[model samples]
Target: MEEIKLEKGDFRKNIAVAGLGLIGGSCTKALRRTKTGKIFGIDIDSGVLDKAAGCGAIDDGAVDAQAILQKSDIVIIALYPRETIEFIKDNAGHFKPGTIITDTCGIKEPIIEAAIKYLPKNVEFVGGHPMAGNEFQGFDAASPELFFDTNYIITPHDRNSGEGIRVIERLAALIGCRRVTRVEARAHDRIMSLVSQLPHIVAVSFANLAVGEKDMSVFMGRSFMDVTRVSVLNRELWTQILEMNNSNIIDRIEDMIDILQKVKNALSEQDKNSLQILFDNAVKGKRMCLY
Candidate 1:
């Protein structure tokens, strides 16, 4: 990787954010409230770009990423995990020297590894995860305050420059993140697999259980809706993410199976003590998650 001298004060000259979906659009909305330079947006859908620009999420829009990225000092790739990797590999050579690229991709290791391998030596890539979102999708559902008080995790690589990391951290602050922290990329993946990805899988599974059930909507309420809401997962993105962290996710799923099996056996035997213990343990664990 070649080290290039960046022009003084070209530090955060401009920003280009690709993929104007919920996270990307919300990021743009938040950054627009700051002194950050002109925000440029890139997406395959011209309609999305037009909508984002009209809604003030971006100052300009384009389908040609290289065209926008060439003039930008920072680039935020708010794309899916697989698309994020391919984007880096495909256009790495076009990124301006000293430009810092970061991503909102949920999983890290694969995207960061591919980016580290392909990005120009003059450019830097840092990984960021804003632990926030809605059950909704698209730019129309974006909110300027979406990430307010949310946890922003940064996983910086050894090759990353101090300036690059600071710039991203500044962006996090601009977007109203309540806390900013760092973790190793692999550990980030494993932990996220358990906390984030596994829940989505479990939700989808629970939803599937109702596929053929009749007249159950009458009994369904906040609890079922709350638990199964995320089951309406982004098929493409979650499919890749769940697969990427399959080992961690599978371990969690198997654990859930064992717990459920225990519950079934205890109920069948009419063991009040066992049932009490199980419910008591669940109550204790649930209390641990209080906000």
Candidate 2:
């Protein structure tokens, strides 16, 4: 872990972002807004790259990932879980030595493992997950303010260099994230399973159940809309995330199911005492979250 000094002044280095969808497009736009770097976008879909260019999200767009990697000082991966690994394995050799690489993957453990196993030792691959997104996808949904006032988590492994982590932290700050927290990859995945992945699963399930029933529309209200808002998220993206973090997600799901069973039993037995106990515990736990 060498300590590399970041140059002060305008960060004019060329940044290549793979996958010109919401996350990549937002990153490019944010970097451009900072006037810090020249942004280049790469996507497997030429249409997405074209759209990103048309939106002025990047200085240039290319379908050839290797070419983008060859010219980039930093590479930001904003692809799906499997695609992110494949992109790194496919184009990592093309990256310049000492180039800083980061990703916006939801889960961290698998990505970090892939980076360690596939990427060149000289290139720095830091795990970054910006805890911000809308229920939309594609370049059209991108906003420079996507990361603003958000919390960006940097999951650094033992192999990660301090300088690499700092570079990622600075990038989060540059994108206007209010806080950056460093944690282990496994910790990140586990916590995210409970907080993000499980909630999304519940939301999708609720939406699916509601849609399957007759007269469901008549029962819908603002509360339903607020709860299931993320149910409208791109299924393809969510499928990737759910499958990638299946183990942790399944654990959380089982825990939630157990909790639900307790509630069901208490209600079925007409146990007001048990119901009150559960309600009290819920309120106490929620109160602790006020901080």
Candidate 3:
């Protein structure tokens, strides 16, 4: 593989970002803020391309990605998991040799597999996930500051070049990530199932419970709202996410159920002592996680 010439605080490479939705758009905006490289945007939506260019988040954009792939030194794919795979498969032939391709997919294992199988041998793929986002979706909801002080995770394969990993780490820092850590792809997915997927499941289920209760809206408070905020999920996107990572998520769900069962049993037995202990443990756990 050819070496990518990237210097500290200076990346003059042509960086093409495929998919200009929330994560992608926010990434583009953050990259533009760095003023380190020429950023190009790609989206199926012509209007989105215009909006991205109009905001100066991109030097240029196009619906056709082949042209951009040919010239780009780095490509950040921000499409959905399946779409990301398909995009690579469809455009595998066009990427320039030594182009470092990475993706912002929620689950890393499948994306890593797709990259290894479909991409050209000369093309490098680093699996990445930005642990930052809101319930909102699309470019209109994206903010350049979205990644500020957020955590970014990279899951690199053994075949990946060391420089390619370093380049992504630097990009994460430039985009305002407070920390950039690397983990194995399978471990990354399992961890996301516990921290990310389970939370969404709980939020959506709780929200649905509220929906079933008449007059629930008037009684809603901050705690309830906070717990259910992410329930306003993109169903299509989440369906795919849940399906793709169902095995891990299912294990997490069972673990959650066991905990909930303990809480239920304590309440049923009118054991105030057990309830207090459980609440205290939860409080301590929350405090411990505040790094």
RMSD of each: 4.7, 3.0, 3.1
Off by over 4 Å in 2: 1-10, 287-290
Candidate 3 per-residue lDDT, tens place, 19-40, comes to 9999999999999877566899
Model 3: weakest 10-residue lDDT segment is 1-10
- Candidate with top lDDT is 3
Candidate 2 worst ten-residue window by lDDT? 1-10
> What pairs collide in candidate 3?
none
TM-score of 2: 0.91
TM-score of each: 0.89, 0.91, 0.95
Candidate 2 C-alpha lDDT tens digits along 99-187? 99999999999999999999988899999999999888878888999999888999988788897888888788888787888989999
Give candidate 1's TM-score.
0.89
What clash count goes with each model? 0, 1, 0
Q: Rate the local accuracy (lDDT) of all candidates.
A: 0.86, 0.86, 0.90
| lDDT tens digits, residue span 44-100, model 1 | 999999998887878898998889988888899999999999889988888998888
lDDT at 219, model 2: 81
* Ranking according to lDDT, highest score first: 3, 2, 1
